[model samples]
Target: MDPIQGKAAGTAPVPLSVLDLVTVGEGRTATQAIRTGVEIAKLAERRGFHRYWVAEHHSMPGVASSSPAVLLAHLAAHTDRIRLGSGGVMLPNHAPLVIAEQFGTLEAMAPGRVDLGLGRAPGTDGATAAALRRSDRLHEGADEFPQQLAELIRFLDDSFPDGHRYARIHAVPGPVQGPAGRPPVWLLGSSGFSARLAGTLGLPFAFAHHFSAQNTIPALDLYRESFRPSAVLDAPYALIGVAALAADDEKEAHRQILSGALSMVRLRTGRPGLVPTPEEAAAHEFTAVERDFVDGWLSNIIAGTADEVRSGLDDLQKRTGADELMITANAHGGEARLRSYELIADAYGLPG
Candidate 1:
């Protein structure tokens, strides 16, 4: 892949990527969700998407990607070129050394086609997070994310300091040489804290605009302003993940987005479950409060015809100066979701 170049006035098409939550839709099983995810990854690679990433979410009936490393390995086996990674893996749920080994093993398998995008969030509710961490205290590891990130990097690079306690503990299948060296590490954030940390550490940054659109520009600005040259990156590089749903027509796109909108409503109300079908979303009645919440949530989503969505994304890139755009789409069914990506890819003219 070529280094990302700035687009003047955002007229030039930027690299596009996919961030899959592996959502298990209404009446669908986790098995079916995984199958759809793998199929989408294969299609995404063939359609010229730069990367196909899976997100981590624990104990969520709607989301099947509880273990990004495991899903990434499966994706790596099915796809050839598109980079496979965690859109991100929530680092607070596991130990740094464990994540290093998991990703190190993935790098050994896929060689140059692996990335490690790390997040500080627990990726689950308090109960589930505690279960995953095997600790009673929730968020105990979150505060140590920066230290853990640095340690994980050292493990991947096999560059632990000589006198460090973990210096002698080498991660098997450690850093490779040439183009397939240790997988690139990216810090994922929805706030300025992580943005500044990524900058200070000189790592690539990916902001979650899909869920936190209001903070996208601020986080990106902080990342760029605080960046310092390091061995991994000489200049600041950032990607913004957005929620997008494209269809042949604007009405169809809006209808498809209703399912996700309904799902968000349920999630925010502490009743999260499988993503409902369009029919269910259509029949469901919403109170004024729920309507307002859903409306505000939907405001961040780009839903329209191919051309319309493409225009919105272009404007977003211009405003954020994002090096790449990672899109996540959820629809009533697998085919509609796939079509959304197809339409966006066609509009962007991505080469296979």
Candidate 2:
């Protein structure tokens, strides 16, 4: 594939990527949603997307990506070229060795096309996080994440010091099969804590700008200011994940993006449900407060016709100074989401 070059003026020529939540929309089953995710992986590869990442959201009725390793393994099988990864796995909810083994197995299978993005957040409600960890002591685990991260890296590198209790243990299929050895590691955050940590460790950082737009620039600043050179990086590399959607017509794009904003309202109110259709959003009566909240949420998203979305994304890249932009299109229907990517890819003239 050729280098990414946006067709619009003032657009930065940065790589574009995908972050799939594998949303289970209204009237669809988890199996159907997962199949759609597979199609997205293949489409992304064919469209020359820089990478394809599935998020690890559990116990949410609207999201189906509970097991990123399993989903990514399936995605790797269907797509040969695009990078596949988690966006990401919650480190506080699993043993370090387990994560290393899972992603290492991915590396062994996909060779150099794997990335391991790790995050401190649970990615779900406290109850689900407790269930996943088999412990109610969640705060302690979250606090110990830095140590856990170190342990995971040691396992991935097979570099534990001699006499350490786990020195003899190994994450099978690790010390990865590819010549690149271990997959590239990225620290994901929606806050300054992880931004500073990622910078301190000299690893690439990805900020969740889609939801936490307020913290995006501040966290990126902290990352760059705190950074120190290390083997993984000589300079700070930052990627911002943005919520974007595009359609053939302006009104259609507006409707689809509003559906996604409504879904967010549901999630925030502790009433998570399948992604509502555009028709549903249009017909349903929104209270003044809900309408205001939805409007505020919608402001962070870049949604419009293909040309508008392309220009918006370009301006975002330039303003944020992000090395790349990973778009997460959360429109209600799979077809809408698919078409959004298609239109955006064509608008950018991505080498497919």
Worst 10 residues of 1 by lDDT: 2-11
Reference-based lDDT, residue 81, model 2: 81
Candidate 1, residues 3-95: lDDT per residue as tens digits? 222222223367788899999999989999899998889888888787888899887788899989999989889988788888799988878
Put down candidate 2 lDDT per residue, 263-303, tens digits, no spaces. Answer: 88888889899999889989879899899999889899999
User: Distance (Å) between predicted and true CA of 299, model 2?
Assistant: 0.2
Q: Which sections of candidate 2 miss by over 4 Å? A: 1-12, 176-180
lDDT of 2 at 286: 86
For candidate 2, give the lDDT of residue 119: 95
> Candidate 2, clashing residue pairs?
none
TM per candidate comes to 0.95, 0.95
Give each model's whole-structure lDDT.
0.85, 0.87
Clashes of each: 0, 0
